[model samples]
Target chain A: MSDLKNNLPVLYSYFRSSCAWRVRLALTFKKVDYEQRYIDLIKNEHKSEEYLKIQPFGLVPAFIDNKSGQTLIESVSILEYLDETYSDFPLLPEDPLERAKVRALVQAIAMDIQPVTNLRILRYVGDDRKDEWARHFLAEGFTALEAMLQKTAKKFAYGDSLTMADIVLVPQIFNGVRFGLDLNAYPIASRLYQELNEIPEFKATHPTKQADCPEELR
Target chain B: MSDLKNNLPVLYSYFRSSCAWRVRLALTFKKVDYEQRYIDLIKNEHKSEEYLKIQPFGLVPAFIDNKSGQTLIESVSILEYLDETYSDFPLLPEDPLERAKVRALVQAIAMDIQPVTNLRILRYVGDDRKDEWARHFLAEGFTALEAMLQKTAKKFAYGDSLTMADIVLVPQIFNGVRFGLDLNAYPIASRLYQELNEIPEFKATHPTKQADCPEELR
Candidate 1:
């Protein structure tokens, strides 16, 4: 890894991490020129004392903005920061209530779905039951999310615009499919995933297309 | 339960739910005059079709704003909406990076800790080992949160003033103590919790002080 400079904005990310992928999408969509510093989760680089000093939480996808002189942890915070700092492409809506809708959808995945079914919890669920557990929580979360989308989704997760909801939704869908969930079970979410995956921003930023994805997987 | 009129803002909450409690705090701290419409998770009321229509996610702490005519789900969204719409005592900071820091601290509990140790996941962990599972994840999340708080907290979870970080943190600390994790382990968080609990707002809105808390628990 290159030494993180004070001038360039940095994203400490792992290629396949859903949390990190959200940051990548935000940067790409906003057309921000930021450097990437991969924290290999498979190698337990996030747990190292060196990484801990930077992000007390030892999580993947920590963002450092030279302009702000702040190293931000948590994907939601990074996403919000990027949207606020780079106003060229806004990820949230203008109306306060509309913005609230967008954020609710984002948290459907962030707060409700991701934490319960994350890699850490799966490890505790044990190797044998991991897939089963992931599939169950993903499906349950999707069931509710699907119902929500029915009322809100127009062309994207919230109307025709691509907001933070879509940013968070797609990668979570990626994880669901990886855990053997049939996307058709939640058709609205599945449709949005299809529509979002077709966007140009997704091509360069897909997990398989990242620098660190294994050759066989790519 | 009173009829949820369009004229009054109503919070769909169960007093004891940590997520709901956060919403209650935001509403109280903002000094917004809102009514509570209880959806008892203990009775599986949240899972019913009637409640699901209002909050498709079947989660506690859904909010409806009279002015916007919008029903908002997710505590974070509601908290943000209350802050934005009311604009009296702001829960978020003005500077973008500072706001990100407050939000990151909010998610340290909301996304990382709450989802893993919440009532829903504890049920999955089974009756025999619920406290054990809750304690383990609480300690791990608190350890990381404690480190971060040392850098940020002064009087509250963020510096001196009450922000969304404190709103999210105190309810979570309430849950942590309920599960038998000693608060002293995370001194910074504990100190803030101590200061926050003694405030008059908390006294009126604590879980034990709420309308629906049963007599024995109260």
Candidate 2:
């Protein structure tokens, strides 16, 4: 049912997967020409045994390079690899300390926030309590994020340059609105989100802009 | 109740904090002589306003570098900073692809595995069926980790070297045992866990060996 059998540098992605959206931003920013394979999470396409072969975690946005035939999973790792291999729009800062700061910001959302507030946990909480659970975790995470962003943000998440932290921030802010999170509470992050969305790469790779986002959502 | 004030490369750690343990392993491997400041999660020390200044997320394993006076939160970020700052016992591989692979593995555990089965989620699920909840999430995470390790692992989590992936695995595996999850289900991870634990660096930085571990538990 899918043409996943390919040799070209392929991205196994889903339209609404914020994790997948992060990859799309990196690939687009670096100006790398690559093929996109939409894995419909709504249809449970990502959980198939075949898909699991590509991403053992059975998550969207698994990447495979045509050059080395390397299958890279995990958004941060994939972003790092593309940045290293492309060398065009370097996602990481030059200084190790700055790079570490950017990475810490990246993981603060990726590890702490996203995982706690994701759909899997939501379903576990059940529909009656999902919104409460989502908002609680999102606000909790954003509280910390707001404080960190205050210290870290200059023009973007880490200085004037749009590092990996900014790429990660876009979708998280979008999700905050979706979960009915008050953007006013995280003033710095909301400002940075607006600034980041001005860039074509960020806008183009947005959840609603994706091909598989469905007609109504678009 | 604690000597929580210091600035000599201090680590906010706990006896059984796996997140903090990752930092300990990195510091030990790099042979960095740093001061340890235990934040007792059980005593709600990490949740205090003063501690929140050190770590906005109110979590343990926050590190402040002596030289740069940079306070780094999140275990992976701190681990990475230590790796980059100290040249000894490099935690990441030289090759970009290999490093990405290692990082992906690190996050596979750090983001996916650990966050899902941590104390936060366990408390959310409550004690009535916490074991079942933990085992389910842990097994799912480990299943993917096991499959990924089978391919990437030679002796350790990523080849023969003790990379960050291995550092992450040791604690997760310990958690697997604690949750009463049968290690036999994941052959590769268990064997690699054994091989990794044999190292002095791994043994020395273990959760049980830390100073704040309660006497009876030790």
Candidate 3:
């Protein structure tokens, strides 16, 4: 275990969680160096006594700022905290109206889409039904997201320059691809995903590229 | 249809949606009057051509401010917008750190719990497995929430004053009770839920109290 006295931010993450990926992208974009502790969700290590103290929810991507002695859960909250504390690359717009717009778009994906297709929720559907459930929900959410993107796309979800929305969209699209959902129906989203996937922050944090990602997924 | 030219704030809502209920509570708390337009989720009214123009996602509680012509979806965003624009009872704290704590608590309930138990996701789980899935997921979420509440509760989720966290919590706990989950395990949550339920803003906006809640649910 890394010494808490070092005062660096530590992220407890799994290799493949979209929620975890959001923070990884944000930290990389801001150029913050922090230690990483991997929690193997497949092995249920997240729920063990040691990990549970850090994250009561047994969710990955709990960020610990040893400097402030602050531990934050919820991916979006962590993203905002990092942006506010670091103040390097402004992840959210300065104007409150624009901030609300960015937040609404991010929440659209975070609250609406991610929870429905998360690994734990999929497991509840049983193995035989998991893929079907994943495909069905992803399609339902993507249809709406595609419509929003088609109407709102102006370089990114709101305008030029990456915001919290882009951070959320890329990983979700990655998951959509993993689930074999057709992207032809969502041209704007597909284009944005293609563009964002090539960005250094996103590419560096890609699940397959993560230092901890297993060889098979890589 | 309310005239877009008029400066009225319009709320597109399904009477029983907890999300819509949250906005209603805020509007009432802020003493902001809005014309309530019912979108019958049960009858697929939200998916109708007319409603689709207003809300591409066909989700309940889409808020449109005719004055500014600013439209917003997502309950938390709407709550924050109202808090920012009106500046009445502050839904969030002024201090950035305090605001982060409130937001994190709200997101814990909104992103982590509510989406997983929403009607659309439940329907996707199919009737055969909906109850089991709902029960299991809600129980898991509440177990963690209960622990969080135990640590944070001081008359409210954060302290003596009510915040957005309370607004999100009441509806979720109401749903938890409706699903027959025992609240006895969560005294902190139970105490606060009982306390918040007594407030006029929350009481007036109770799901059963809504004009459109079905007879069966009532």
Highest DockQ among the candidates is held by which one? 1
Q: Give the winner by DockQ: 1 or 3.
A: 1
**What is candidate 1's CA lDDT for residue B197?**
93
Candidate with top TM-score is 1
Give the better candidate number (1 or 2) by DockQ: 1
Lowest lDDT block of 10, candidate 3 chain A: A1-10
- In Å, residue A131's CA in model 2 sits off its true spot by 1.3
Cα RMSD to the true fold for all candidates: 1.8, 2.6, 2.0
Under the 3 Å rule for N, CA and C atoms, how many clashes does model 1 have?
0
Cα error of candidate 1 at position A15, Å: 1.2
Which tens-of-lDDT digit does each residue in B153-182 have in candidate 2? 997789888899988888878876898677
TM-score (chain A only) of candidate 1: 0.95
Candidate 1 lDDT, B1-218, residue by residue in tens: 23556478888889789988988888888787888888889899999999989988788988878786678999998888888888888999999989999999999899999999888898887888788888888899999999899889887888979999998999999988898777988888878888899988887789999889999998
**Which parts of model 2 have CA positions greater than 4 angstroms off?**
A1-8, B1-7
Show where candidate 1 strays beyond 4 Å: A1-6, B1-3
Of 2 and 3, the candidate ranking higher by lDDT? 2
> What is the DockQ of the complex in model 2?
0.83
The CA lDDT of each predicted structure is: 0.88, 0.85, 0.83
Candidate 3 lDDT over residue span B85-188, tens digit each? 88889888776666677778888899989999988888777788788878888889888887777666798898778888998898888877776667887788
Classified by CAPRI criteria, candidate 2 counts as high
